[model samples]
Target: MIVAEKKPIEEIIDQVKDFQKLLIAGCNECVTVCEAGGKKEVGILASALRMYFMNEGKKVEIDEVTLERQCDHEYLEEIRDRIDKYDAVLSLACGVGVQFMAEKYFSTPVFPGVNTCFMGAAEERGVWSERCQACGQCILGETAGICPISRCAKRLLNGPCGGSTKGKCEISKDLDCAWQLILDRLKELDRLDDYEKIMPIKDWSTERAGGPRKVVREDVRL
Candidate 1:
């Protein structure tokens, strides 16, 4: 899942201080799972903003709404009729969703409400751990499903890096050594011998930084 955390309220307030009418938009997708920009979060933020303004003797028009997804044009179109009513939009979505809203409403100011964290899994009720860097190349099959790119500080294709101490990473005592994780997983599956394989350098051309990559099936194209 695309794990994210809410941005600081103070930071968000700075972006739309001049706008009396603000729309706090949330998404029902990734950010929702992380509890960063779900419908409930939208209400909480909206109320807080109202209280903050009221305390300062300012009358601000703050409305909160949640869309099925801020990234989809079809879903965002539903807000077109209501969007013009606000001076600025505070997107409580991931960076992608915020950008999509900005692209669709170029005349209105758009602000981000969350910081996109990492590609991770939900470990528990309130815990999420980084698992993949989405580096445009995948090496999980060869490494017993443990990702070196995201977990290892060095991003070493072959790791333990001569820097790991005991079973912890050298960069931080709190982190488990990524190579140690790979070895343990490989040992459990009796695939320890596979660790000798040298991973190829990642081809970054398919990544977002390379400019949007797309796939089209001519057979399906009408």
Candidate 2:
């Protein structure tokens, strides 16, 4: 999942201060999972932005709404009519969501209210850890399903990058060396032989390539 953090209320207000009418938009997907851009968070931000402007003696009209997933065009269409009434949109979603909204509504200026973070998995209730770098190459088959692209500082394809000290990555001692974990898992499965295989050069063009990739199922296509 892609993680994100909400931008400061003050900054958001500044961005749309000149606009008397504003719409605070939220997403119910990854940003919601991270507790940054959910419906509730959107309301809070809307209220805060309103308060900030009001306190400055500036009259501002603000309304809030949440889309199930801003990345989808259908959900975005639901807000088309409502958005037309606003001067600008403050999307409390990830960068992708904001971009999609802008793409869908060319007349409206969609502003991002969150800083998009890395692709990661949730650790606990509020903590998320990076797992995949989306490097266009997957090496989980040989490394016991652990990704080194995001976890390892060197992104080594085979063995430790020889920079690990005391099982910690040299780039940052706080992080564990991804290769070390791979070795342990490989040993447990008696698949250490797979480690010797050389990883082929990754073709990034195939992953996110020429244009936006889409899935069209013959059974589901209209």
Candidate 2 lDDT over residue span 1-222, tens digit each: 889988887788778988989999999999999999999999899888877888899998999899999999999999977778999999988999999999999999889999999899898988888998765557688679888777887777767977887888888877888999988899899998888888776566646664566667999877
- Top candidate, metric TM-score: 1
Show pairs that collide, candidate 2. Answer: none
User: How much does each candidate deviate from the true structure in C-alpha RMSD?
Assistant: 1.8, 2.0
* Number of clashing residue pairs, candidate 1: 0
lDDT by residue (tens digit), candidate 1, 119-197: 8988899989999877767878888888888889888887688888888998889899999999999999999888887
Worst 10 residues of 2 by lDDT: 206-215
TM-score of each: 0.92, 0.91
List the pairs of residues colliding in candidate 1.
none
Give candidate 1 regions above 4 Å deviation: 208-222
